[model samples]
Target: MAQKYKYARPGVETTPWNSLDVRVTDPFGNRITFTQRLPE
Candidate 1:
């Protein structure tokens, strides 16, 4: 999935990790991939 990061105010910067894909496993042993979009 494609991810995007946004800043709440002007002249703000976004981090590299904010636009990356993250993988996690659940208790049922299933792998899930999701985007990490964060606001600054």
Candidate 2:
């Protein structure tokens, strides 16, 4: 799933590009956040 998301672009209805936020919850009830920048 992460591989697919890496190449995905923001949809037309979404906000302007600056950064992307990704959140994931593990089975152990731990929450993780990821911040990514758009490619040049």
Which candidate has the top score in lDDT? 2
Task: Provide TM-scores for the models.
Answer: 0.37, 0.44
Residue 26's lDDT within candidate 2 is 60
Off by over 4 Å in 2: 1-17, 38-40
Candidate 1 stretches greater than 4 Å from native: 1-19, 36-40
Tell me the tens digit of each residue's lDDT in model 2 across 1-40.
Answer: 3454433333322226766777666656676666777675
Model 1 per-residue lDDT tens digits across residues 1-40: 9554332112333458665565556656676666657865
The worst-scoring run of ten residues by lDDT in candidate 2 lies at 6-15
Cα displacement (angstroms), candidate 2, residue 1, comes to 14
Report lDDT per candidate: 0.53, 0.55
